[model samples]
Target: MMEDTIAAYSGGTLPGAIGICRISGPQAFALADDLFFPTKGGKMSQGPFYTMRYGQVRAGDGRALDLCLACCYPGPSSYTGEDLLEIFCHGSQAVVACILERAMELGARPAQAGEFTKRAFLAGKLDLTGVEAVADLIESQSAAAAKNAASLLQGGISRPIRQMREKIFQQLTHFYAVCDYPDEDLDPFVNEEARKVLEECTAELDKLYQGFQRGRVLKEGLPVTILGRPNVGKSSLLNSLAGYERAIVTDEAGTTRDVVTESVRCGDTVLRLSDTAGLRETSSQAEKMGIDKARESARESRLVLCVFDGSSPLTEEDRQVMETAQGLERAAILNKWDKGALDFPEMEQAFPKVFRLSAKTGEGVSELCQWLAGMTQGEGETLVTSARQAALLGKAAESCRMAAQSAAMGFTADAFLADGEEAVRLLDEVLGDAVSEDIVHGIFSRFCVGK
Candidate 1:
């Protein structure tokens, strides 16, 4: 356990209904006794460790700060596995400042960023994956994001990693025993069984690594580019999807001279929509720069929405739009459907997934939204959202593949043993077992001070 006691304002913004001051360490209870006086006239350190008591919180000079409730939790049972105290008081900023000042005066230092959670980690209350999940849960913006983060916090990824590590360790143990003692009646190390185990672990790790991109889409939103010529209603489509007038719509062609971005939530999925300038030959330098950016956005995005005006006959510019979006994952959006549709044989061949929507009336937008939401469709499976976890998993999978190859080729035990051991070491780092202190500090540095 840490030697010095630490305290911080665990409650978020102050000046509201309630505020919480958290203290944890060896001197937590002693500091509580000095700062709070119970209404019924008994010390909290005496009995009823987990119960809260009505009290008056006082400053360093014995001046009453506020009337509130205080609770004490003894060591090995609290959140940090240390004696902890919590003071629930009014949310006034002045009151909280005085209480914190008094805490510092009484030998409790101010807590650092994520110190409380780091303490829990060091005390064995949480593993590395759980530590990361705590941060993920706090930063989750949607219900789908929160659900996945909650599953990670509940050991959805760590459990399988631990099981795979155990299985590899067992295989290593059997090989070592068979080589060390030739006279014993132990079961022989069969190459086929060992190869199967390694292959299974490799496949599982690959699956997890593959899901990282989808998890990123869930957490960071999918990138989408709107591509079309001037006067094609691309900006209108952007405004319709955003449910607001995000981009200015005008009857004049080439009104939008730059890319306008807005994050639109289509059901559970979030699309980072970019309404780029219309693609056309222009003399203006600014419009030319915008067209270049539009093409760049199409190259970088996962999906491109190629738009065309359905009320007018297809022009050469429309054919250029299709050619620009060639070899890309794209869909056709025929805008101004309320005005009436036109038949285009080439458009039908260019885009298999086509949607005819009237951006002015918001008709047929829901179908497009539903299609975008289903693009990232691994809902119930475990996903690795952190880049660190995904990189380690990929390396571990490669190591397991090498080990499986050695086993299948009937190589000597030591040949595959080196790769197997490296795989376990990488897996341990993923679990925060063999990680460096610098990495640990870097991971927790992203957390808020109160956490």
Candidate 2:
């Protein structure tokens, strides 16, 4: 409940450089007074808020726990928009545990997972998108992901959505005013103006919705599959890209009997590489199953690297691999270039993006990595990182489109008013305006405790 004071350990793992114990709520300063004493001898709540003060944290029995730095943030200006206290102490498991135990013993409850951010949301400090952005920023794996999350947190996605909502609200307001006050001399609603506004909002929402796939790839690495006949250096190429011996390599055929996956950093982008079993006929049941999995992996992959042995001429197995790669976003890898250069005119003709790389020597690997990274590059536009945001935006876009169609068809304002109102409501849900308590708790639950 909002009436209760909450405390949590907001630091990294034990034995870190420092540990942070955060206490927030109406009784936060009271708990601070009980647990922490300023070295200079004054109540922390008296004055000089937002400044860290050197202090000694004492346990319930009046024994010192640890000498530390403590800061007081008197709210409605703190992260939770409530009275908050943060104690910076040595990051010992025992010390953090003792301090937290003492705070709870003095009536401060343990903070639930993401309760702080949830409190911020309830206190009008953050919108739903911004709260989701907090989780995305914390879980981001790469620089691009982090940058996008930071933008979302800073209102990149929310700002445009809010503007769209405002325009729709204005249109709705005018329509309602004209209808409700037919006796008054008010400006009549223009069908053309309403259509134009709806069209613009619909287009913007569509564009944002379209970027969800790429944004998803930014968060969860692009799925890539390596396909080739046995011993064509498919595993070797995976190892080369992974910068380690991720796949076992042997001169014997049918070495890999399953899909070996690795999420490797290809330049700036992450590639979820699946090194599948060789795509060749086999008498072994397990190897055949593996080959089936290989084909399935290629089908599901965003990019398929069809590898071929440059040393040997085209074989039936290699031709089969090429045939399977048809209609897929694919590239050709003329692997084992160090052995001998052979003119594979068919490979060049079938695949436009071809790379001659010796997986053994790691030659041409950097170029491939750079190219893979370039595939995920954006033009500095805001992206929809959360699936929930994208889904709602998509629905809102469809609603707007339907309403625009009604306006263009010369229908009365009442005909399109339902859809227009639905669009506004959906957008509100996206911004956490009318979302349910369950949804809010579910969103914040994704965060770790003390966030």
Candidate 3:
């Protein structure tokens, strides 16, 4: 690799105090030396490998800049296979800017956003799926999501994809052998044997396919709306899940006139619960908009919680509300259990997945958690949660389908072979064995600079 790439990355952005200002390439150590001007103990930068040198930072001038730490990483086994230099500086914006400015002055260029990780991938230190996992780990909101991302980052996702691609390519070669040399002699085409191999490949891939649905939900949580008439304990439910009063709770009806969203973990799944205003025919202009938003959230949810005041008798208002939530994966909540039920008895029959509990008292919340957990069990292990990966895999599946059909059609071996080779190439695309520059740019562009 040319040092010009380093020249191209003249000066990079700093993300703040916690982030390291890294300069990786052939001149990493030299760049560090040029940028560093210590104001403290003498000869600290001359330490052994894996040692941190504590000192004051400096600008182009010999003047002290900020107190900083410089850590060195060398060669082939490093995260980015290039010689890497990490300057740990005071997280202040001014300190970061001065160090970066000085580095560029000394011929050390700034690293691009995710450039280190990209370099790692290019150097064969990581696979495509592993690269995606780094992004996921950064974006993960919940513990479970972080764990899933970590698993993928550790190559839990890529190992399987690699294995599957290898098997499919091997089968592809065999398929081509059959297609190219028919009964005339070079190779014998055994339909049963070939079908068995093809079927097994498809079967294993399909198992991974089945996991995508659950994985998609985990990666992007299922939108579950918590809705009901005003004063039906919607805010109470929100507070309980958020573990604090995120939404204002009041005895007054219509206190919450807009949708309030909070995300919580139910076992391994992240549930985005939207607590919305009570649905009703309101004359007030503001209330009407709130009601509209509430309805919209409910309609968009993968699941809905229709709450009713179990302590109060069922009214026509409740019936109207329940009717609106039909045809969804729904659970009915009989809130205010502490107050005791009145003459209203239609809740159990109206919505079958009825939960008799009090959000205020925190009863029966366990059952709700268990149900939501079951909804997304075994989803984290899937490889296709990423939309980009799924789209590519789907394309590979279509190419496979084309090859299968061409094989069955009794087409000339040359034509059939073209289809088979194309299918293999598409599979390579899915595995990222061959990637377009557009894809590389699209994925890495989303990353923040100085990654």
Determine which window of 10 residues in candidate 3 has minimal summed lDDT: 4-13
Regions more than 4 Å wrong, model 1: 178-189
- The residue pairs found clashing in candidate 3 are 17-91
lDDT of 1: 0.90
**Candidate 1 per-residue C-alpha lDDT over 296-394 given as tens digits, one digit per residue, 9 for 90 to 100:** 999999899999998899888888999999999999999999999998777878996899999999999899999998987675987888899999999
Provide the overall lDDT of each model, using Cα atoms, as 2-decimal numbers.
0.90, 0.92, 0.71
* Candidate 2 least-lDDT 10 residues: 182-191
Which of the two candidates, 1 or 3, achieves a greater lDDT against the reference?
1
* Higher-ranked by lDDT: 1 or 2: 2
List pairs with backbone clashes in candidate 2. none
- Report the CA-based lDDT of candidate 2 relative to the real structure: 0.92
Where does model 3 exceed 4 Å of error? 2-19, 36-57, 64-68, 178-190, 342-352, 379-383, 401-419
TM-score (C-alpha, index-matched) for candidate 1: 0.91
Best by TM-score: 2
